[model samples]
Target: MGVMYRPPNSGQDQGHKMHHKIESACQKGKVTVIMGDFNMQVDWVNNAASGPKEREFIECLQEGVLEQLVMEPTREQAILDLVLCNEPDLIKDLKVREHFGGSDHNVVEFNLQFERKKVESDVKVLQLNKGNYRGMREELMKIDWEQSLVGKTVEQQWQEFLGVIEDTVQRFIPKKRKVIRGEIRQPWLTKEVGECIKAKEKAYNVAKSSGKSEDWEGYKNKPRITKREIRKERINYEGRLASNIRNDSKSFFKYIKNKREAKVDIGPLQNDAGNLVMGDQEIAEELNKYFASVFTVENMSNMPTIQESQGAESNMVAITKEKVLEKLRGLKIGKSLL
Candidate 1:
């Protein structure tokens, strides 16, 4: 899903850039949907020739294999609003509703036609705090790796050692699965806020049925109180996160990352054939193929001799373990996606 709003005063340059970006998104070969107040006066329904900018934008959609779904006029008579999708049947029952709020453009409502993807979250985790660390240590200490792996190949030796460690962990560690009934509510939602929410719902229902002024006023006042309670609870919860960061840095960092609203997941990708790849294995293979195609590794064994420029001398030196270690020690560790 994508949203865009191109200003009317902007010239062809901005439009071209926006078109390129949208085209690239479509190239990802995902279940794509792009909607915006494009400000393009294109006659998509009648197949009439559009202006320079409109033609360029339409050409881009064509090149990217995108289909325009919205046909009705959104703002006055001209079709300034558009809903573009790569899949022809992905968008269904698109309705042009009345003007939304103070906006002049009509609200375009549509249902996406596809099975919603369910993301699997962890239900069970290793309970490291209850693990038998002493037993594991004693068991590991009993193994004489040098004598046991004396004649094995390096890979085989490493595998055998890994197998022992895994067995030891399994024997000593404990894990439990949690049963989650529904989507987990926010940790910040306290009893006061929950009660406020219930009161607000009750007031709304009473006001809707009676249509009394006092009942409506009672309903209206509930939101302000609810908001205040919610604000206080959230601040208290965040304060707790900050205070406990040393002991639970992961939770604190996770909350901070969520607040940042960053998209970290690898989006739907496609191979050279332009077919959607969704499965983890398939996506990985497609990415590998793309990276392999882009990156060409040269054979360093065949070196080319280059003549040094005049007045320039080579100052190459052999790398030492101490020097490498010193450089590594000076380097700062950073968080990276890789």
Candidate 2:
């Protein structure tokens, strides 16, 4: 269960999806040994930022009871290559070898002696297509909310609302649950990079057969330069995305927001009585109680009131169709409706 060369700038959504896929696979495998080029430069020793994808990968390993074996830098200057195992003690002689086989990724060597356990896992994932939000809205509009909620208690009303929304989601969006198998693909591994890698491989084979030092050196240097080119292309691709901030502002902002979405998984929390509360119901109740106490008013007295100063001119202007149209025109185009 090794991942090689993750998409660098595919954004956080893909990274999270990839992490979950890997985690699910690890869970099902009896003796999991996940390795390969994660492309995340993590300084686990120094408590440094390892980017969102790397952080998620680390969290996945933690939750799955997996331990990373490779501790040294495997790439040029970064520990991009990783080797993880469920039984850290079982994984012995874990080290990064020199670049081999015409590849830029350094080889990770490890030994493990454990019986493969047969584990069954079922993962039900709800995937959403937010792009079809217009269709979702149309479905919602077709439902008579007032009629559905009529003659019901507050709790019943809430239940009805949830039921309708869940049903709508099932209808409008597609969902599937199945046995988890790790099958992650790198979309950013473009054809050009593929050709460059192939060329390096051909160079390596030729050097090996001819026993030429220059050819071997070329094999080594070619892959490095190719990797650099691939990296440059990826960076340039992100630069194009940055340029979209003006022309395609909605997508630009959405990308930024998704990239920064919280990956932290908050587990069970303790209540005031020091009892650990789990599940949605207990968590919501605890949160509501805490907020209610914080916002509770003691005595309602001497409240401040607003009074207009004498001779102060009112800034309110009369609404006009032309003024409204002008304002609308002034607003930036391609902005999200909501």
Which candidate has the top score in lDDT? Answer: 1
Write model 1 residue lDDT over 1-338, tens digit each, in one string: 99999998888789878988998898786878888988887888865546788888888888888888888778878788889888869788997754443456767889888987986767777789999999999998999989989999876898899899888988899877765589868889988899987887677568657979998777666767787889899999999999987567788888887788667778588667878888876887788777788887899999899986899676997899999999877654432322
Q: How close to the true structure is residue 331 of candidate 1, measured as C-alpha lDDT?
A: 56
| Reference-based lDDT, each prediction | 0.81, 0.73
> Would you list the clashing residue pairs of candidate 2?
none
Clashes of each: 0, 0
Candidate 2 lDDT, 176-235, residue by residue in tens: 676555875443567887888778667756865786888877776876777787887777
- Candidate 1 has an lDDT of 0.81
The C-alpha local distance difference test score for the whole of candidate 2 amounts to 0.73
Over 4 Å off, model 2: 1-156, 168-188, 245-262, 296-298, 304-338
- Residue 125 in candidate 2 has what lDDT? 58
